[model samples]
Target: MTHTPVDQADPPTPHRDLHSEQGALRGEHPGRAENPVIKVADLAWLEFEKPDLDRAETFARDFGFAIAARTEEALWLRGTFAGPPCMVIRRGRASRFIGPAFRAAERTDLVRLAAATGHAVRDIDVPGGAKSVSLLDPSGLPVRVVHCGEQLPALPEQEPLLLNFGTDHRRTNTTQRPPREPSRIQRLGHVVLETRSFLRTLDWYLDTLGLIVSDFLFLDGQRRRGPTMAFIRCDQGSLPVDHHTLALHLGPGTGYVHSAYQVTDLDSIAAGGEYLAERGYQRSWGIGRHIQGSQLFDYWRDPDRFMLEHFADGDLFSCDLEPGWAPMSASGLAQWGPPVTRDFLGANPSPAKLREVITALRDDNELDPARLLGLMKAMSS
Candidate 1:
């Protein structure tokens, strides 16, 4: 038998038509406004109301937050980075997320915002002295834009672990061991929320706070209907900022989903996960890289069942890049990780959730039967 000559040419490579930021903007919303009221500098802090302050303080410490100030009525939690506290938990009869506060780039921005919105600028009664203009979003969530005259000084930084790589060993003879402690949080990265009026809420952020969308996700068969999810970032001109400072998705209910805080690296995420696990805290979903921001993330639940995340190595983008669009599905959440948890997806049925679904369907809002069915399908997918 004559032996056939071995094929010398390489196999044909599959072509992937990757989506470009500019190309994705075709016939879609520009994810920005022509003239915004005021461009926010960054997220200042989140506010919450909890019945138990001591318990909240304990979890805050375990979640790697430094107590900036604590009183009988409130607790202010800060990260290692300088700025305002990451969050404030106030004493209340019920436990719930109040809302998010954004930092104004200039004090005059607050005056402009107040004039445009007809809300008066008032002094914020927090540890840091600041003036704020408050307004309610379309979904009835409280939103504040604040300008602080003084910021908390930067804390001592937590150095990243030295590692050894193949042919580029940086450490010799040194044992690799990250301590089993809470991951030191650097700063608040982003907050995710679910709203029934997604389009209106998204537009409000873009027009009011001058936020720009970094990415948009629509249901599998509903691209014409518009995006159901958006990852928004601050418009810092040419300065690169976190890929998403705020993310919103359409759902039956309107409320907080989760918030992420940046840590040092992967070792911080893993070792810190171990620390939380040993303390009997519940891990919701994590040890994976996200597709949108490309952050290595780990999520956990606090005593009040509020979700918080420890994330690192997130992508940064400037204002020049337009928003990229993609189809939303369970599998699209992360580039590589374990299956998304049912808890994180809110798949577990509860009485409150059932009531919210019924009310959203009956009322006049963006969510309808078709959109609800699409959301269900996306979750299952």
Candidate 2:
């Protein structure tokens, strides 16, 4: 979405009780890698493993992805617009998120990445066949960089409804009524993940992908606790990009929390949610704008119970912007909406997952017990 230029000069900045400078996370660390082979351009797609390809396809199509291609063992789903598959579902016994893939800014970046990471550039085995090199993050999550892929041409988009305002009437006669259709998702806006090693994983992403933090959330009233979550955007020079292409949260286990897709507008999100509800799908949370990225969002559960969001009118950031810091809590999740759900907060942490988190804390020093207690206090507040 495009908007008229507004006064950006000395914009009022949001306060972070505990704030770090924009590049604070990029400072030298003894064990961190020295340099990235190349920076990525944008997020591409997410990989998943599911036992039932048919069920995944049904939910994906209803969720707004067009079937890019289908094989007996795999499924490739994309948004209405043209691009490489935005999602890949592979047949497997267990259902889980595999990882996320990114698009490289330059084709040569792939060669440098493969060489630097000691992984050979290999052919992508899904829709829009492309060459890619894969790397693992600090938490051992697979991240891929692709040199090239087919761009599916744009489909007919849903035009925004001309709405009349209290003071200004844009529509003179016609009553506004949106269709009961899956709000056409324009593109994948961002992928949010939960990781045990929040700081290490956050630093790894910042250092390697050249991603810049847009916002940092920490324990309320505990500025000394450090950042526990991040909303990060791609570094695209002076060009404005989505406020966040990726988000990370500190949680009991490491895996996908949810992925957000862009719709046309508020109508798209609401009408789309209604369509899904009419189809008997569960609404996870949303129909509200978030404070961090400022996206009007609506979340739903897919066939396999993975969360997918339909969002619109999100904020975009220029390279000149600095990171904003805020307190993290369930109540802080949105500016206005129904109370945040337990599932969204990763509440009721299983004993096994709790043990995994304890192990990660014992082995890696990201936060101390005081900070952890502060984090718990913030969450339960």
Candidate 3:
């Protein structure tokens, strides 16, 4: 399908982000897209190297994960849902992100990917037994796709509380305290990353994992430069999946940006945030509805400063759905929230960060000076 830019003659009033109307604009990516040999279904778990496993495990529990396995060297964490471990923390001298693992759509896809890429397929000995093929993504991050894991049984779920509205009353009497407990995350929802080569990295993912674009965002006034970021989802055919299982943004560093997990509801998210706060965990940004996925969210900083999100009620799309295109601006991030934080925007300056921005400005393939300037202007606006 062909895609054209949305006309800017009469823009909508500044009430919310342009995702709803803009999400209707969908089509094929600009260039040739081959069908990948393997289709990854869901984000499995994230790997992290932390100096203190105890501290990391503590934060994970407060953020609503139950301990799946804990050894002297590593820890496996999961939510109430039946799945493999949602997070793994390994003891290391310094804290750093390891990367995320995905569950392959079919078990044979793992073998297919291994045969095609010549990467060795290894048998996993962890909690949910499986076979996996690991490959380095274009962003130079390790990506593992696993298959044939024993599905863990779902634990008890927190039932959604009945809310009373002015006109529509569902509940008869009970007021809600929401348990003052950890919001039981249902599953690992999505992961976001920042990479150097935007198009190259994006194409690599599409060609490797059979992922499709759910939405694309570009710097304002630079449509010709293509998109600077894309919220990508797996092609699950008639089955609806999250708006984005993974998203990539153009940036200097190739590292983990954040990972989101689905909680029960807004009450879970809010009360969970309160629990984290009382425990002295840092709230990054949230308690807002995002423009892209439309998930009600709250973010927090883990013990190692990794970004983790608690989200609920995200948009889902069938594989037949096309992608949305929009401008990437700070204001375009959320429908309702406090102003976008500098840290969330990754605007914090370091000598290395300054150099990365400078290097990006110098690399025409990465981003032209005009487009970079336009992005800056958009952020400021």
What's the TM-score of every candidate structure?
0.94, 0.88, 0.91
lDDT (10s digit) by residue, model 3, range 53-106:
888878888899989899999999888998788988899989998888999878
RMSD (CA, angstroms), candidate 3 = 3.2
Ranking by lDDT: 1, 3, 2
**Residues forming the 10-long window of minimal summed lDDT in candidate 1:** 1-10
- Clashing residue pairs in candidate 1 (N, C-alpha, C atoms within 3 angstroms): none
TM-score top scorer: 1
In candidate 2, stretches whose alpha carbon ends up further than 4 angstroms from where it belongs are: 1-36, 349-368
Candidate 2 lDDT score at position 52? 92
lDDT of each: 0.88, 0.77, 0.81
The alpha-carbon deviation from the true structure for residue 304 of candidate 1, after best TM-score superposition, in angstroms, is: 0.4
Ranking under TM-score, best-scoring first? 1, 3, 2
- Candidate 3: count of backbone clashes, pairs at least 3 residues apart or interchain: 0
Off by over 4 Å in 1: 1-19, 23-25
lDDT measured at residue 375 in model 2 versus the true structure, 0 to 100: 67
Clashing pairs in 2: 82-152, 83-152
Model 2 scores a TM of 0.88
Per-model RMSD to reference: 8.6, 6.3, 3.2
